[model samples]
Target: MNFERRNLSDDQLLDLYKRLLKPRLIEEKMLILIRQGKVSKWFSGIGQEAISCGITAVLGKDEYILPMHRNLGVFTGRDIPLYRLFSQWQGKAAGFTKGRDRSFHFGTQEYKIIGMISHLGPQMGVADGIALANKLKKNGKVTAVFTGEGATSEGDFHEALNIAAVWDLPVLFIIENNGYGLSTPTNEQYRCENLADKGVGYGMEAHILDGNNILEIYNELSEIVESMRTNPRPVLIEFKTFRMRGHEEASGTKYVPQELMDMWAEKDPVDNFRRYLLKQNILRQDKDDQWREEIRKEIDDNLLIANTEADIKATYEQEVGDVYAPYDFEEIKPGSETENIRFVDAISQGLRQSFERHENLVIMGQDIAEYGGAFKITDGFVDLFGKDRIKNTPICESAVVSAGMGLSINGYKSIVEMQFADFVSTGFNPIVNYLAKVHYRWGENADVVVRMPCGGGTQAGPFHSQTNEAWFTKTPGLKVVYPAFPYDAKGLLTASINDPNPVMFFEHKLLYRSIYQDVPTNYYTLPLGQAAVLREGKDVTIVAFGAAVHWALETLDKNPEISADLIDLRTLQPLDKDTVYKSIKKTNKVIILQEDSLFGGIASDIAAMITEDCFEYLDGPVRRVASLDTPIPFTKALEDQYLAKGRFEETLKELVAY
Candidate 1:
C-alpha cells in the first residue's frame, strides 16, 4: 500500500498553511492563558502541528477520531470549538466535558470524535473497536487513533493492532513519534528503529512519513483514508515529529539537554511549513498577516464567550441514586416458584431471556459458546442462540473485554466472560480506563456485562479459583453485582443486561451449581439498588453479598432462637444503603459477611457506610465475617478456612449472647 502525493495548486497550499497556523496560534494563546492563571494547564503541539492538521484534513468529518492529549491541533483542524478547548483548560462548564474531565478529554459524537485520555495507549484498542463497529455496520468510515511513540510499548497497542489487522478493520493508527514521552526518549523506551515497523509485526501496512512536512503527511493520509473507505484495512503511519514543549504545562524541560532542544527547534514543523508555503508562492507576508489577525480575533472573541458562559455543575448525589438504567423489572420478578433450579441455571436462563428480548445482545468469551464457559454457567447457549450471539473467542482476555467495550459503545449489549474472575487483571486497562470512565468522561453509555466466574471452594487452585470482586467494586461508574440465590441471579443478570452502565457480574463458581432455589420462568428483573430481605427478624441485621448471603441465611436458619434480618446486596457499587439502614434501625445490630479477603473487601465498605450513616442504630460494633487475608489455597481444609461459609453461626450466636 502506497500513497501518491497530489499535485496541489498554490491556493490549496495556502489554505493548508492557514489551517495549521490556527491551531499553532490557539496553542500559543493557551500557553499565555496558563501563565496568567486563566487556564490551569496546557499541552502544546508546537512542532507536531503539521502531522495533526494533515491527518484530520485527510480524514472525513464523519470518520471517528480517538486522540491523545497532545492532539489539540488535530481537533482544531477537525473544527472542535476553540472556546470549548479553552474552557476545558479553565475548568469551566463551557468545555466539552462540562467541567467533569480534564482539558484534553474532548469528544463530540456529532463530530465523530471519541474522546479518550491520559491512559497512555489503551485508546488504540478503542479506536479499533470503533472501526470494528463500522465494519459490522458496513459503514464506509475509518477510525483514526493518535498516540505517541512511547505509547507503542503498552500491551493494549499490540493487542488492538493485531486484532484490527487480522480482522482488516478500517482503522488508521497514527503514531505521533514526538521523539520523547515525558522525559524518556524514544530510544530509551524501545529497541525498534522506527515505531511504524511495529505495525508490520501485526501484518498491517506500515509507513514512516516526515511528521514535519504537512504536504507529505496529507498526501499519505489522503490515500490511506480513501483506501480504507473503499476497501477497508488497518494501516499504521509513524509521524516522525518532535515535542517542542514539555509534555504538559506543569512539566519542566530542564532534563532535556540544550543541544537536543536546539536540534529539534531548527526542525520546527510550523516554521518549516511556513517556509514551504512561501517557497510555493502560496502565502505572502500580507496574506499571512491578515490570516493571523483573523484567527487571533476569532480566538479572543470565543475565549470571552467561554469565560462568560454559565457553569454546569454535576454531583454524585444524582448518580448515587438509580445508577442503573430505569426499566420495568416487574416483568421478571425475583424468587422461584419451584425449588429445584440452581444459581447457575438461573444465570443461564436470565441471560437467555435477556438475549431473546434484546436482539442486539451478544455473549462472548473463551470457550463460552461451545464449552459453556469454564464453569459451565453458559452451557447450551451456543445451541440456543447460535455463534453470532454466543461467540466463542480465542483465549485472549484483554481482546475479549476490549472488544466488548467497543461493542457496547456502538449500541450492542455485550456480555464478556472472563473464564475466572481472577483473570480480570488481564483486561484491567479496558475495564478501569475505558469501560468505567466512558460514561463520566464522554456521556456515552457503556452497556456491557462482564461475567466473571469468581470465588473459591471447588479446589480449582489459586489460579482458577479466586474472588477479585473487590478489585472492581472499588472503581466508580461501574456496577458490581453478585447474586447468592437462583432468583437473585436471574433478576440481577436481567437488570445488568438492561442497565446503561458497565456491569461486573460476579458469579461465584462454587455457588453457581451448589445453591438451588425456585426461579420464575417469566421475564423478571430486580432493581439495581434494591436489596432483598431474605428473612425478617429484629435481633440483628446481617448484611451480606454474593456467596456470603447464603452463609448469612444458613446462620439465621441454624440459630432458631436468635432472630435476624438478612439483607442480600446483589449490587455492590450502588449499595442499598437505605435498606441497610432501615434493617439496622429495626435490629439495632449489624454484621457484614463477605467471601473475599477481610482486608479491603466489600464488607469493609459496607461497615464504613453503616457506621457513617446509621451509627446511632447499632447496638454493638458492626461485625464482619470474611475470608482470611491470604491467597486461595488448593487444599479443601485451607480453602474452608479462607472462605466464609456457615462459620458466621458462631458469630451470630456470640452476638445473640451479647
Candidate 2:
C-alpha cells in the first residue's frame, strides 16, 4: 500500500477502518435477510463502501449529504441509530419514512442526510439548492451529492452540474463509476473518457481518485471540502470503482464477465483497507477482530429490535391525511385604500411584499434577474434585493426546480419560475415525483412556489400558451392556485408563498397587461381552498378560473336577463368543494369553464364532483365550457376559434334555460 496516513491520528485511522467494516458487514447480513424474506431488497455497496465512509468520516455534521442507494456507509457513519435503519428496511412504522417506502428512499432532518429518489440525477440539483442556502446564510457550509456513472447520461446530471458551476454553489458532486448501471456497462452509458472530464465542460474543477483506497479518498476529500467551505464553488470528483455485487440482490450480474468480477474482487475496498491498517501497525490483529465482533453484535441487536417492530398498516384515512402538511388559512381584514394595477403588476406586488416579509426568501428562474423574466414581471427586482436573492438560473428546469426543494429543506423559501407553463414538462419529474411527494413520503415541507406564466390567447403557440393547471390538480401534495382578476392574483400568490406545501401559482400571460383592478396595496392573503363569488344570481352558477373567468363575466354582461352566480376557483388542488356545492344547490345548475382542452381537463373533475355530491340538487345535468381538443394554434384567428370564449356564451344560455 503506497498510500500515506498524513493528517489523521492513529485513533482516527482505526475509526476509518471501523466505518468501512460496518457497511460491508451490514450488507452481508442484509443479503441473508433478503433471501430469507425477512427484509426487502437491498442495493449492495459491498466493494464501494470506501467512498461513502471516507467522505462522511471527513464531512461536517452540519453540512448536508444526499446519498445514493448504494451509499449505505453514509447512514451508518453518521451514527444514525442502527435499530431505526433496520426498521426502515423491514418496512416497520418506526422507520424514518414510516414504511412509506423501502430502501434508502428517505430523508432524515436530524442527521442532515437526504436519500435519493429512484431517479438518480434529480438529487444533484437538490443539493445545489442546499448549497445555495448555505451561501446565502454565509454559514461556510457545503453540500455533497452522489450519483453513478449510468445516471450521468440523464439530462438532470448535466443541468445540475451547469447550474452549480454558474452559481458557484458549494456542492461536491461525487460520481461513483461502479462499472454498470443496472446491467448496462460504462462504455454503453457515455462516450466520455471519464465522468470527471465532463465536469470541465461546465468550467468546474474535476478530479479522478482511486475509489478503493480509503486513505487517499479521506485525505484528498478533507482538503477539498475544507477549501470549498470558504471559497464556495462546485467541484466534481469521479471515484473509479466497481460494484462487486449485482445492482440489487434480485438483479444477478449475468452481463458482467467472470474475469471482470474476479479482477475487481482482488481490489475490494474493505479487505484491502484492513490489510493496509494491519501492515502499517495502526491496527493490531486482535484489536481489529474485537471491533469486527462488536460491529456484528450491534447489527444483530438492531436487527432483533427491528424484527419485533410492528409493520405499518394500510389505514386509508391516515394515509390520505398524511399527504399535505396542515396549513391554516385565515381571511385578512381588507384595507380601504387600493390602486388599479394590471394583473402582472399585482403578481409583482405580491412577490415584493413577500420578500419584504421573509428575509430569507429567494426567487430564481431563467432570465429572471436582469431581464426580469420572459415577461417583464420582475423588471426592477434586481435593484431592490440584489442578485443573491434574485437568481437568474440556466435553462435547466429540472435542476433549478429541484434546487428549490433543496433550499426549502434548509429553511429558505424559494420561488422557481418556469418560463412558460408548457415548459414545465421538462421539469415534470422533480415537481410530480420528488417535490410533490416529499411531505407524504418523509414529512419534509417543500416550501417552494413555482410561478408558471400560463394560459393561451397571446398567439405564442403550443409550447408557450398552455393552461396546464389540470396536470397538477390531480397530483397529491401540491397546492394549485390560478386566479382570474388582479385582486385574486395578488392575494393568492402571497397566500401560496406563505403556505407550507408546494404550490403551483399559474399566471395567465394574456392577462399580464390586459386586466386592471383595484388590488389592495397591503399584504393580504386569501384562503386557499375557498371560492370567491364575483356576482350572484338565482338562474345558474358559472364556475371558472384564470382567463376563463373573464369569459364567464363577459357572457353574463352580454345577457343581463341570464341571472347567474359567477364563481372563481382561486385554488385548484384543494378545490373549494363546499363553495361549489353550495352554489350548485342554490342555482340547481352549473357550467364549469376552463381554457384547457375539453378532454381530461380540470373542468371534468369539477363537473364529476358536483354530480356525485349534489346530484339531488340539480335542475339539469352539469355543463362544461372548455377549449377545443387540439394544440393551441399560433395564428390569432385560429387561436380565437380554439378558445372556450366562442362556446361559453352559448353554453351559459343553454344551462340557464335548462
TM-score leader: 2
Give, for candidate 1, the lowest lDDT window spanning 10 residues. Answer: 321-330
lDDT of 1 by residue, 375-436 (tens): 78778878877776787765666766777766776667788888788888988888887788
**Candidate 1 error regions (>4 Å):** 1-5, 9-11, 250-254, 257-259, 310-340, 378-389, 392-399
lDDT of 2 by residue, 1-658 (tens): 3567897889998888889999998999988888889876888988899999999988988889999999999999899989999988877887888788889999999999999999888899999999999999999998999999998999999999999999999999999999999999988878878889998899999999999999999999999999998899999999999998889989989889999999999999888878888888988999988988999999999888988887778999989998998878756755788999999999999999889988989999989988998888888999999999999988889999999999999999999999998999999999999999998999999999999999888899989999998899889999899998899899888889988899999999999999999988999988888889999999999899889988888888889998888999888988888888898899999989999999999999888988899999999989998899999999999999999999888878887777
Model 2 CA deviation exceeding 4 Å by range: none
In order, what is each prediction's RMSD in angstroms?
3.1, 1.2
Q: Provide the TM-score for each candidate, comma-separated.
A: 0.92, 0.98
lDDT of each: 0.79, 0.91
